[model samples]
Target: MKGISENMYCSDCGKKVKDGADICFNCGKEIPRGINKYITAENLPEEYKPISMWGYFGYQILFAIPIIGWIILIVYAIGGAPNINVRNFARSYFCFYIIAATLLLIVYLS
Candidate 1:
């Protein structure tokens, strides 16, 4: 009901479409139903919820520390973390560190 309107419009050509219609009369494009819409965390299935601000910052802080930070990153990146979001974040963060370290090494060796 949120994305639906009294008179639906074809997203491709912006032509008015009739209710319960599958295809646009003017454009002949299929009228999208419950698709091509932004799905927020609230709309997502129960297994996933958007990461909280504090949890994000906490991971950032953990990654900032030396030695133990790398260990934690490796653990999470390897799927030790229960949350998919956290696992992905850790993997990306570890990749960033690896790239940064490689760049520094290249500069130092040069």
Candidate 2:
């Protein structure tokens, strides 16, 4: 089996870092405990509104072709958003996609 490397980016600072590194070298941001489990709305800045919402929804509808949608998501995430609810909305949208994908796959393979 081929080993796939998981990329790490600082959750708080958005700086790229080594996967196993304990802290972000770029911004000296401490990696939060259980950072991988939840994405919060408050941390995001105020410039990423329009894209994240559309980009998050696009992920579900365009799951089979993710390249474009992912690009949009990255843009929105990096740009930031003013609304505190935006991130949570996006998070729930992706969560729904997970359930929907599982059901669809089961239906298709049955």
- Which pairs of residues clash in candidate 1, taking residues 3 or more apart in a chain or in different chains? none
In model 2, the Cα lDDT at residue 88 comes to 53
- Candidate RMSDs in Å, in order, are 10.7, 15.2
* Pairs of residues clashing in candidate 2: 48-80, 48-81
lDDT of 2: 0.57
lDDT (tens digit, per residue) of candidate 1 on 1-35 = 46433455688888876665666788789856565
The digit string of per-residue lDDT tens for model 2 on 28-91 reads 8877755433334543335434455666565556533477755444443444434435555545
Each prediction's TM-score against the native? 0.57, 0.33
